[model samples]
Target: MRKVIGIGETVLDIIFKDNQPVGAVPGGSVFNAMISLGRCGVASTMLTDTGRDRIGDQVVSFLSDNGVCADYVQRFAHGQSPVSLAFLDEANNAQYMFYRDCKVDRQDINIPDLHADDIVLIGSYYALDPAVRQQVVALLDQARAAGAIIYYDINFRPSHRTDVMKVTPNLLDNLDYADIVRGSVDDFEVLYRKQDPETIYKAEISFYCKRFICTRGAQPAVVLADGGVVGEYPVDTTDTVSTIGAGDNFNAGFIYGLLRQGITRDHLDRGLTQQQWDGLIADALAFAAESCKSIYNYISVDFGNNKQLPNHI
Candidate 1:
């Protein structure tokens, strides 16, 4: 069976609203997307690290409950699991503060077996961190050899701005390995000081990857310069309860669309038809909007139960 593999960090998100504690959920960039895929009954597995403590137990349990395979997670004995405190504002967007043990590398991540047409998701500072670069690259190389489609999400935040010069090479390397690259407007602003999706794509993203997608919060997502295709796809607007997993679930929906539409490694090189792009982006918009309507980092259980989309692959 085809599967989706994700490599990233895992954090317990302690949410606060108006300075008061609200809820806590397991979250990370790729981790959030994998969870959503699992909820949708997509074959999903995660490669991450957590402490061998109660928080680690909770994290593993959450993954299993949501249907993600947690066998590849490395439970370290030396440090505590990471945690983040997210404070939501009036607009329902969050400002985050994280707590973690500073470490050089996590070495024991067993790369999951990859097969042709499988999808591998990777992003965030985890993709650029020098400490774990070797392990990440090992998996990337395996996926490449197996003809898996690698999807890169440049989930760069302002917190990583100081390392821009240092990690530019790693960023470019990831772009080179990626079959599809997605980034938010905020991510681009921090990387290139550019706001317009078209400008950023033409200047920064095109040389490394042929497919680039740029998203703006509540604004139409730009499918920029992808195999001579350029269009603005509008978002599904809704009264957002939280914007935590909007982007992550957008990714989940996109991958789900690929599986359902039978898009494979073969189709990526030949380029997708206009109709295929429509199906992918529509699923992306709908999943993102659905995730925004709730506080959970992944799509609500209710949404997954009624999603009705079948994974043909």
Candidate 2:
């Protein structure tokens, strides 16, 4: 079976709601997705770094418990592992405050030899950080050379806007390396000061990536594929706990669709018909919705139970 290789940060999330501590879980954009995929019986490996502290040990144990391979996770001795305090609002959406110490140097990542149809998922600050951009690009180049499918998630946080200009080149370079590019309305707005997904696609992002997925909260997610005509999938909303890692799990489901249908680099851009696209995105939406229903950072059991879609092409 082809594997999923994820490169990103790993942190412990301590959530608080209504002045009460609610739940805690290990999370990172790519890390969360990798866990979901691992649980689905996908061969998943995470390349990241954590401290040698208690939180770091928990992160390693958590990944192993979820069936994620942690052989590539570098353990540092100097600092404590990163942590995020997520405070939930009335809408159950999380606002995060982060604490970090040791900034990992990417020279330590052990990049495994990849196979032709393997999928590499990378995103967030981990993909765009100046210190690590060269290493990230190099890995993507290797993955592309090996004919692996590269999926990039532009999970740009608002706090990083101050450095947007400084990081634009690296960000675009990462997009160029991607076979499928996924982002959110907020991501584009923070990076380009643009709220319109269509406008961002037409003006800035479409040329760099042929398959573009733009997700808007509580609204229809947009897809711009071969020939640049637009398509959409509306979200199925429900009563929620918190919106943490929703997009991450969406990537998991999307990649799951691609894998289940046996999509590979040779046909990754072969333009699925409307029905096919709907089938794949249905899984994506379901996984994302399931993540929102809990305080945990990944998919719930209910989502895993209903994985099949009968009408897919």
Question: Which candidate number maximizes TM-score?
Answer: 1
lDDT of each: 0.89, 0.85
**Inter-residue clash pairs, candidate 1:** none
The stretch of ten residues in a row with the least summed lDDT in candidate 1 is 304-313
The sequence of per-residue lDDT tens digits that candidate 2 reaches over residues 1-313 is 7888999988899999996888888999999999888777678899888889899999999899887899988988777889988999999887888888845434556798898989999999889998777668777988989999999999999878898989989888988889888999999889888878778888888788878899999999998887475577888769988898789999999998888777767776676778767777888987888888888988865455455333331
lDDT of 2 at 293: 80
Q: Which stretches of candidate 2 lie over 4 Å from their true place?
A: 102-107, 305-313
C-alpha TM-scores of all predictions: 0.97, 0.94
Write the residue-wise lDDT of candidate 1 on 72-146 in tens digits: 999987888999999999999999998998862476679878999999999999999998899889889999999
Per-residue lDDT of 123 in model 1: 93
TM-score of 2: 0.94
